[model samples]
Target: MKRDRSGHFLMAQNARVLYVPTTKVASSTARLLLAEANGTYRPERLRWTDAPNISVDQGIHNLEVSGLQYFEFLPETQRDHILKSSNWWRVGLLRDPYARLYSVWENRVLLRAPSPWLKNFQHKCSEVLIDGRLDYAASFRKFVNVLRAEPEIFGDDPHFKSQRTHLGGDQVAFTHLFRVDKPGELDIFATQLGQRVGMKIEPRRLNEGLGLKHLDVMDAQTASVVEQIYEDDFDAYGFERVSFPSISPIALASVGETKAINYARDVTARLVQLSQLARYRQRSRYLLAQILRNSGLRRHKKHR
Candidate 1:
């Protein structure tokens, strides 16, 4: 898939660095940081416009990272090649699945600040706004359910896409993948890149939509659903399943007085496993085809 590189990805030939942004993972800061490294960032034009009605009200805006000149724009072919080559320094920002989901629920589902689809999602789910606000927990429950059923819907949106998807999953790899929990790594990355490019770069946090209502009392069923949905994330990043309060194991489900919540969790978990297996099988087939094609071409050239 061709990504919008200007804002979603970053490059610095001087630093020989490429950065892929994972939403809610200090992506705004990384974008500006790389833009500055490439001399395209305009801090003066950066303004915080908070019109609650508009999505841009929450984060930094007006910095056209792509419009500014850069050492290079990383194209799909080039990015794929470079990520696999050790010669080029590749980096990406990743977050803990649990923490990232919490942040998404707080800022995106509850506040509906950036995502256009999310604005009307609550209404579609019969979650009416009370004094211009819907219950965050109820909205988040719906959000998680939808995502579990249709993971493909998240492919285009960075906020909801799996970190593996952004980092090329099993298709391509990065040289240095940093975690959000380990914030000091950002500083380390900045310093390393600065030395490479012969410039000074100071890492700073940007667009942390904090002060929003944080979910401190998540029930067991919701937690189970999240764990199953983000199973890939947990396995890929070596993250442990975080424990949240589960009021009653059996009370999680009762669907109009039908199946138990635990039953739903089991189904979601199995589905996620099957999806992962399918992707892995597909990747294996792709690799085998490439190998065969390359071998045939080599034999033809030898005969010639």
Candidate 2:
């Protein structure tokens, strides 16, 4: 709220950009660029270690919930520093709600399958009703129901009746909001941000190609259902419905290749290690059994 001279200059020139990373958006790519630009931009360090430069514990909403007090938690000088920090911009990326929901499902399929206590309690409604069948509509309904039932979790305040009305009050705070649909707009945003920060940043790809898995298989009916469920997000973000052409073999092959590569590079490492450990354990058990049998034979011979 308190804008210093340099802050004003940056705002006038480009505006301070704070990127609120939402799941499934091109947040990773954006973070990478920011880190390259500013050595201070470290997501993992902020999340894990209590890094001084970045406050990862309190998200945008937390700042809004406890404004000056939130800042006061840091040293008084640090609070002042943040207030006067120049080229400080706040921005966030949000996705088509339905698409985001689908991505959440795909990414967390295993958690939802067994209905673990944490997953069940936290995301009961979103559970698949039938095994091996993905009912998008049903899932959406359950999600909505969960939100409605536990308003406090999604609501701006525990006392607020409607979360939507309470948005932007003291819970949801941002200077600029960018929709994932308009990627070109992000380039313009990045250029402006560069000017403000007095640093050059090439706009690399943001959240693209993430929904490829569902994009090909997402039927018109399912898409329509998603559109209806996430109409609010679509309207807010100006998301236009994208209709894919008939699935081609070439397209399918490309998708498969990409997935395979990602799995091999990112997923296989852990699995391979686990497999080796299991094999070792099995071999050890077999050797122990053989040793016990040989000992038993020796005892029998001595007794005879």
Clashes of each: 1, 8
In lDDT terms, which candidate is top? 1
Work out the TM-score per prediction: 0.62, 0.45
Predict model 1's lDDT versus the native: 0.59
* Residues forming the 10-long window of minimal summed lDDT in candidate 1: 249-258
On residues 115-147, what C-alpha lDDT tens digit does candidate 2 reach at each position?
112223444544343443444434444554554
Q: Which whole-number lDDT from 0 to 100 does residue 172 have in model 2? A: 32
lDDT of 2 at 40: 41
Which 10 consecutive positions of candidate 2 have the poorest summed lDDT?
A: 5-14
Which regions of candidate 1 are displaced past 4 Å? 1-8, 44-63, 66-81, 116-119, 124-139, 149-155, 212-215, 248-304
